[model samples]
Target: MSKLSIKPLADRVVVEPAAAEEKTAFGIIIPDTAKEKPQKGIIVAVGNGKKDEPLTVQVGDTVLYGKYSGTEIAIEGKDYLIMRESDIFAVL
Candidate 1:
């Protein structure tokens, strides 16, 4: 697991989004403007859940989320998403 300098405060998590697809099934290369946002990512950091509900997700877990789920942020020259745990839809 990576040791990040930033930590989430509540049910928020930091996710490293998977790279956007470079090509289609038919071997067509996708242009930057045509490439879609990735919805799956690996969790890098997480916050403790609310007092009563501890978070089920943990660092290093690969997860699926909505297309427009989290807020985009940059740390240490890398892109990451910070969103509430509720933004995550499922573990992969």
Candidate 2:
């Protein structure tokens, strides 16, 4: 699928979440209810920083965020998150 065309606004960022783990190291399959929420993702779009506060992240940067930070969105059947730059904890 093609990338999302939407652009974020000030202090906001768009992220494509990592896939949920499907199996354990021991070869046990994880049911959907047992899967953990992904906390890391690739930045797809970033807003121009807030006045006097330039954003530290850029597109394509992989980052870690809060468990329930961003709003979930679906673009062209692909899921993504949109959150404030402050919501991102670190770049990986």
Candidate 3:
């Protein structure tokens, strides 16, 4: 699959969440568990940045996210998150 390098405008970020492991706490390895998506991700693509404003983050940065922040997107078989820069809770 071909990857796109389109950058978002304003306060937006492109995140590709890491997949969660497929195992229960009891080590049962439930199918559902394996299918669940991970909450954490690395910053793959970033926006052009705040227009005429300063930003504290950049591409390749890992960040903490709110449970309900961002829009989910699937591109070329990969999952990604598109959220407002302000939605980012913290950078790790």
Candidate 4:
């Protein structure tokens, strides 16, 4: 696939969320209704710093974020999250 054309502004960032697990370790198949939202993702795009506050995260960084932190979006049928750099909790 071609590179994403979306460009975040300010301290915003674009993240591609990790896929949710469909099965448990005990071999139990989890239904879609029981699946949890992934709190982790890879940075796909980053925005420039806001004034003197430069963003610490960069593209390709695997990060953990709050469950309800970012706004969900779809690009070419793929899911992504757009949120501020502060929304990300840590880089894994």
TM-score attained by model 2? 0.77
Ranking 1 against 3 by lDDT, winner: 1
Query: Candidate 2: where is the Cα deviation over 4 Å?
Result: 1-3, 22-38
As for lDDT, the candidate ahead, 2 or 4, is: 4
Residue pairs with backbone atoms closer than 3 Å in model 4 (clashes) = none
lDDT string, candidate 2, 1-92, tens digits: 25568989899999998766565333434245654533777899888989999899988887878778999998888889999999988887
lDDT of each: 0.83, 0.81, 0.68, 0.82
The true-structure Cα RMSD of candidate 2 reads 5.2
**lDDT leaderboard ranking:** 1, 4, 2, 3
Q: Which predicted model would earn the best lDDT?
A: 1
Error of 3 at 66 (Å): 0.6
Candidate 4: where are CA atoms >4 Å away? 22-38
**For every model shown, what is its TM-score relative to the native structure?**
0.79, 0.77, 0.69, 0.78
72: Cα error in model 1, Å: 0.9
Report clashes for each candidate as comma-separated counts.
0, 0, 1, 0
lDDT of 1 at 61: 90
Q: Write the per-residue lDDT of candidate 1 for residues 9-87, one digit (tens) a residue.
A: 8899999987766654434343446545337788999998889988999999988787788899999899999999999
Candidate 4 residue lDDT tens string, 38-73: 377789989997999989998988887877888999
Better of 1 and 2 by TM-score: 1
Error of 2 at 57 (Å): 0.4
